[model samples]
Target: MESDESVSDSTRPVDSGVTRLAYHNGSWINADDVCLSSRDPAVTQAVTAVERVRAYNGRLFELDRHLDRWQRTTKALDLTGLPSRPSLSRLIDEAIARNGAWLARQKEFGVLWFATPGTADSPTLVIDLYPIDSALIERRTRSGSLLVVTSVQQPPSACWSRNIKVRCRLHYYLADREARQTDSDAIGILVDSDGTVTESSIANLLIVEAGGVVCPPSDQILSGVSLQVVRELASEIGITWREQRISRERLAAAEEVLLTGTSCGIWFANSIDRSPLRAAGPVYQRLRSAFEGRVG
Candidate 1:
């Protein structure tokens, strides 16, 4: 029998299995037992940082890179009162061990870990895991969709912790809500303060032109793990890749467009602002195949 910390009591036998793990302060507990106080500053003013790492075949993909980013963000936010890298790593290991059985059954999922300063302005951490929505993953992988929205105005590097994955994502949520209102699949596009194309709300944006494949500089976008993987795959497969500032007009005129992220992997954008293009072109097909091979 599994320990209570590894399984939730409300989890039903027929409900598709799931495992829960949580780490708070210096103790590891069941996910359900990890609670927060209303007095916590992060709860009141949203002072927290987070990173989401995806698991493929029951193993974390690009874990080191995720940890590096997580550390950078917390330190930038002056929250080093949280556990050290070694301590955090041990907790993550425990989390994986606790969830190993469920991970095996799912084949793929995501891990969300975060840290927020305590109510007294001291270091405190909260880590947990939940199953990825399989239906959403299937839909994104099989069929591409459009993002119909405007760009965010902040320069990527201007963020408080530009290199870290932080939890202050109010803007992202706003963009997503706007996308859904128009029946789009995700946030349409993000723009810099000056209105140049930056990225999609949650994914890096790429455009295929007569010259080759182009992505915006990391200076203006979140350096995504999947984006790096795609670039490496593109190079290995003989596709040209470059980083340049792209205008809205250029994106709409491109031969192809795609979004890359931890959750979505790779997805073609059939249109931008209702301008249509091929849904599954040769470049997209080749890149997707290469990426899937690497992950599988």
Candidate 2:
């Protein structure tokens, strides 16, 4: 029921029958046992760099790539005290082991890693593991999703690039609020300063045309992990994938629109600005099949 939050949050409740374990600093702790100060810069300044990874068949999906971006982002923010890539892998393995039984029951799992500027001495690091709610995933996959273009255009990337995958996300929540006025379950589609379609509140946006699939340039969007996979899948299926400026009009008229992210690989948005729109065009169908074929 969570809207405007990360896709993982929308897919899993706080307690999804998994007594989730979270790794913080140097030890594993109960998810409920994890805490931070009210004044933590991660909160006060919203300066944390984050990465979300899904576990498939007990192993992280694209683990190295997820961690690599996380490292690059934290370094970009000049945040220190984060764990090394090797250390994070070990911690993730331990977390899965601690919740092995619960994890085994899941089709896939969510792991969120983040680092924050801490108590002036060092930074705070945390990695949380949660189970995905199959029911919610099925609903988004089966039932068509919707998007509404809001007046709240994405702030200029000159201020902060979405490429960093950080917590500077208040604007998204507000944009989603505007979208819900059109449809309760609708999400927001943000446009860049130049009026080019960028992304949705929680996922990267793609428009399928007769020629190919198009998404915004990485300089303007988050360049999500699922996006990379989908691009490769499209190539395999003989559908072109490219970066382009998608106007709101182009999106609404598109043969198909997709939102790619950690939570749902190629979720279709069947409507734009509350108007009916097509989804799962032939090219999207082929790309979806190719992408899903790899799931374990």
Error of 2 at 103 (Å): 2.5
Runs off by more than 4 Å, candidate 2: 1-18, 104-107, 277-279
TM-scores for all candidates: the values are 0.86, 0.92
Candidate 2 per-residue lDDT, tens place, 36-135, comes to 7788987788888887787656667888878778877987899866677797788877877887766666676777777888876788887776667667
lDDT of 1 by residue, 1-296 (tens): 12111111112222244546577787777666776788876778877788877777777888888888887788787886777789778888787788666666654566677788887667678776656656666666667667664745554465464456765666666666666676645555667776778765567889898747999887777888889999999999999999998888888888888889877678778667766535677788889999889889
Question: In candidate 2, which residue pairs clash?
Answer: none
Q: What lDDT does each candidate get? A: 0.71, 0.76
TM-score of 1: 0.86
- What lDDT, from 0 to 1, does candidate 2 have? 0.76
Q: Which stretches of candidate 1 lie over 4 Å from their true place?
A: 1-19, 100-107, 159-161
In model 2, state the lDDT of residue 132: 72
Give the C-alpha miss distance for residue 70 in model 2, angstroms: 0.4
Top of the candidates by lDDT:
2
